[model samples]
Target: MPSPRPFSRYEFLIAWRYLRARRAEGGVSTMTWISLIGIALGVAALIATLAVRAGFRAEFVDTILGANAHASVYLSATSFTNELTGEVYTQSGRIEDYTDMAARLAAVPGVIRTAPVVKGQVMATAGDRANVAEVFGVTPQDFARIPRIVDPETSVGEIDAFPDGIAIGSGIARELGVVIGDRIRLISPQGAQTAFGTTPRVNAYPVTYIFSAGRYDIDRTRIYMPLPEAQSYFNREDVADEVEVYVEDPENIAALTLPLMEAGGDRALIWTWQDSSGSFLRALDIEDDVMFVILSVLVLIATMNITSGLIMLVKNKGRDIGILRTMGLTEGAVMRVFFLCGAFTGVIGTLAGVALGVVFALNVDHVMSAVNMISGGGAWDPSVRGIYELPARLRGIDIARAVGLSLTLSFLVTIFPARRAARMNPVEALRYE
Candidate 1:
């Protein structure tokens, strides 16, 4: 066959031709196909895992920030002794007229809104089942300011709705076998001290709304009651346990601290959502990093096939190399041909893997659903994933990085055998044949 132009045009065609030629043409080999398959599979695995992890974290972060305040201001009193009487005295260190403090905090530049809240633990009983739940005393306006403690579809969170009823998480409802309109008794940790003695405070309220934040921990343990009722139950009326603060940018919430302290006064103790959930988010970051490393190793192992495939081609085509040398083909040209041979596998495999991975990540939820159906009912654990839905996120930057790694490994593997071809002794190579 006439040699095509030996530079860019000809070299690429020659390499591609070898990739597409049939086994009968002494071009395609089993190892070549294996190498392609290996690289493609590795790239796809990496992409799919990354997308899923990203999706899960985004969902987790959104859920957390929505349900919890960006920051909170808490006020409590510590008793001090009276110097003259030598008697212990309870001084007012608490934020007085907290409603005024909330308004002032709201005016701070970064502050988005503020709501007074009373948070406490209560034993909740629904029929025969009982669970300890975190109770929040909030107004309908407060619920609106916070993330949906109940599903919006439940219609229990309207500004005017649930006037005389409590909103509980769907997970708690399921656990207690309770539903909307069910009468549940809440026993507060605080008590009313009277002639009878200090006793646990108890009240019964009808469940008017059920909510799901897609967080198992919250769904199983969080419930909401009106602020006035909470104060009455805890016996701290005209007062609040804390002021929940929402800010414009929660990622930089530390910036709001000085302003908030100025508004809420020196006695205010502040906590941010990040402080509460930092460990969980950090754990997720570590997992993502580890996964990238593990999957990249898989690609490395896959590229190993290229090294063996190139070595095999050199051995099988020794006579061909000799004939090419006789025809005045330079050592450099020979090396280019072999190098292109490996590049064909790596580039083609990387592209194919990227396509496959993107498609798979986008449809991962469907794939998971199909698997669940095939495996029988309830194959997925709701407790582990919060709801039954799969989360998937894809980023262009991440995809590009993964593809780059695959191609780099693929192109590098061909160098060794290509060098050997460039240094081939044509006379000896033909002598054996």
Candidate 2:
């Protein structure tokens, strides 16, 4: 007689035999196909959702970090500058290397570029329309370094065409009914005495460029101007609201923060995006947790189907389990056979789902656009929705998570069935009609 083969090799053969028998016994019936389809749909949904979430997170972060500085330096709260009315004085001991600071920051291992920013809140009015806006003064040269800050379609000459003029957000421009080259009035929050008691001090600044920051709050409220013009217009001599620093590695923020603060001396205070946008970051984390919990319901339901299918397989293959056991198969071998069947079911289901999901995620934009075209419209327009295209980003983290979760659930589904197969009584199983 030939030497007995290991169970691992025979497991596949046993699984195949059981599967063929299942096919013959109407195991792949409408109900079974429905279960498989359910699993596939669940997996596909999970993949697509995660991909879109990742894309949104990435796009928002990139846009924010690109336009805004990675880290910031501002005078302490009480030490805030009121340079417009000449009420604030610049200290001789202020950050000395304003330009050099940017160069040196760029030289740091992870640092990208450091740029100057001036901030103030003021009312922007044009004709009969008036709205409050936040002014962000930036150097044109430095602003160019931040991608997407300038519209790609707009030429460089068009951007700096008018010296001493400022860039306004698209929404703000719309609100004020102004376009590029239109003169807009800015009223500083600092009050001025008038017949109607004290009112905000106001000035007029011309708009040089129109921009869409892609963030509703920023786009609606933020404005940008040349650093020199801002400094002179605000009457701020040798003072800035903050210095924005960009870095290559966001994770090394804390490590660089200490050194940067030390280098900034006494007058400057450093804050990372994490600190500056703490609430937003926290909200993102909460959103992630909520999404995971909600999406995981699909996975859990699919796992239930896997469990049911395995249980049914065990019941139907009781005779096979007995025959295999009688033919000198170990209890572990018998168990492994059922385990393979269940695992294969899960693997096939998951793989199919992943493939479908990849296709869906990649083409979600086209699919959504087609659907939108067919349906006519929604309550909110695309611009109001924050993005025109449905975005999806496939990340290794998402893939690993999906694979790990699906495999773990699949293995779990087989546990009970495997145990039942292992404990099968040969005599009773064979006697069953």
Candidate 3:
């Protein structure tokens, strides 16, 4: 018949026309709105889940670092003798090169400070209350450098201020019903050995100052005193359990581990924050993977709506397809027109979901508060949940993954409907009209 006008640029316009007509149809019921909401909810949940997980990881790590050493150089097996003593005292272990090794580690880039700390586990008793605590012996001047240990507001003198002073955990202090300057008896496992066997001996080290660390385990378990005091009690000098090293950059921790070990040689085993917090970090990673996989199915289910919408559009546009084919439009072009229509729905739904998800993730704390208020519940305690506040870690990688998955599902939904439209018989389709 007459020559048909070119339809390349007209395909987008045609796709929109068909989509709008379908939207206007009487049968386009709850299914349509359900699809949109599903996609929106799925995307929002994914974003919020990841942000919370990241926040918990960061806070937990900070708590651990605050409580423990950033890194430590432990003496594998080393001990030394007192040269000034006329009588000889030999250690079963090798002599630890603390000064030389601490100096070498302190020189490393990102290394902020290094100090020698002596530690031992002893049972401290006051009346009926006896609790086991880690006795940390440190130099007063050097201990002041520790952030949590030295508070200018509370602490007046250096760590050495209390020659026989010990800082106990808050829980421990409460358990014994004692405060600063209370006398506590220290019972060490290393007691006097007689010809018969080991006899229990108790040394009473007056608790000069009791510092509360807040952690029940640590506060109750950790007792700090001067290094000299610990050395005299333990009956050993010129040696320690390990030297703690603090770094400015926690990210490049692995870089310092090997070098520190090399400087200290095989006699010392170097440990980093990662090593100390390995189990916790591993749990966080697994949590992210498990939640992503579980929530992604919601987005996939929502994509089915895109498929159904295109199928309805295909049936409605059969007459148009027949006319276009008769006008010399190829099957591939016919398929592309329908594909473009379905993709528009996918694009709009995905974009809306992303916008909403971002807003929700950002305002999660407020939303949570509102939820609590509505339910008449008290404020959430992060300590119970292992977090102090809601943390949202929104990364480019996560956003990319979400968008990519949504787009891919959208593209796939178009295939069956597009093929059906492409394969329509012109004569058969036109006969119904």
Candidate 4:
């Protein structure tokens, strides 16, 4: 008769019988269940954590790039000598040719749009409430180009009416107890230049619009006004403080920096969003690495149970091994039989974990809503978390990493016990029986 192929039906049948044996027959049925459940939970936790991390990072970056410029160009200070006094004075940098500079920067290959901005800080008051606000003076057309401001779903009021009034964040409106069409007075410390020095400038403008950028800090402290009004209020006539530049791709902003500088001329100083928020991004990267390492340890521990469970099975099936060996079963066949037992548990557990994790990530927002309803609405705090709601995003690479870690550990730990079972002496095993 021809020799049976490797992993033939007989070996599979024997392995299945061993897995299905009852406890009364010296089976490790209970340990097998424990190992399967442990692995499933470990894999699920890792997948879920990675999903949340990815989602949070994406949300954070979206908020930043959506609400603000990718980069800004400012004029460097220049030293000028007084013609008659024979003295030199350093003049504060100002973008005197801001309109021309914006058009020039807009012509760069990767540049999408450019806007001249006049920014300042002032105290805002509405009735009895008052708060400090950082104001951005942008043209109505340029303000409409901001993704977060013009998103119909999140913003209220009209962009066309912005030039006649001012736009305040929802958080600022709440703080000042004001609504659209209400007047809010702004007080600036740098006012008219008189003999006794400058006085604070105070003016009131109707709240023509309100917006929510979904970020706590931005919504709480930022206000938008017409460029003309901002220039007049801040004492900068026919000049802008800086020019905000938006690019095609913010992540690869470095490639465009030299080009933008060349276009902006000698006095231009480019500051990117990366320069301001690089440390935060670096912290997030470190956090992702640390979380993966910690969760990998959990997976390793769960897979260790597979080792223990398989060792116990080898001990319980000692008499059966003796019979099978004496019946002409090769050592390789015996090892394959035991290997299938552990492999089955790992495969099934990983599939189940993947399903559970995917379902959880896809509906994480609804889950948070349900939780908030049950817990009386304190589940998420935007001020503390920097996001209005919890986010979870599933990525293929993350899932693959989790699956690879679990299966590698399971296969490696099964080898020792399977080899021991295969090397067993039938004479000695039957002698004990």
Best-fitting candidate, scored by lDDT: 4
Residues forming the 10-long window of minimal summed lDDT in candidate 3: 151-160
**Alpha-carbon local distance difference test for all models:** 0.84, 0.72, 0.74, 0.91
The best candidate in terms of TM-score: 4
Which regions of candidate 1 are displaced past 4 Å? 1-7, 21-28, 90-94, 154-159, 377-379, 385-388
Candidate 3 local lDDT, 270-343, one digit each (tens): 88888867876998899889999888888899988877877777777788899999988888889889888877
Ranking by TM-score: 4, 1, 2, 3
List clashing residue pairs in candidate 3: 78-94, 79-93, 79-94, 79-95, 134-221, 140-159, 140-160, 169-219
Clash pairs detected, candidate 4 = none
- Stretches of candidate 3 exceeding 4 Å from the true structure: 1-10, 21-26, 78-97, 122-132, 147-224, 232-238, 323-330, 367-386
Preferred candidate (TM-score higher): 1 or 4: 4
Model 4, position 174: C-alpha lDDT score:
94
lDDT of 3 at 50: 72
Candidate 4 stretches with Cα past 4 Å from truth are: 1-3, 25-27, 82-85, 370-376
- Ranking 2 against 4 by lDDT, winner: 4
Report RMSD (Å) for each prediction in the order shown.
2.9, 4.9, 5.7, 1.7
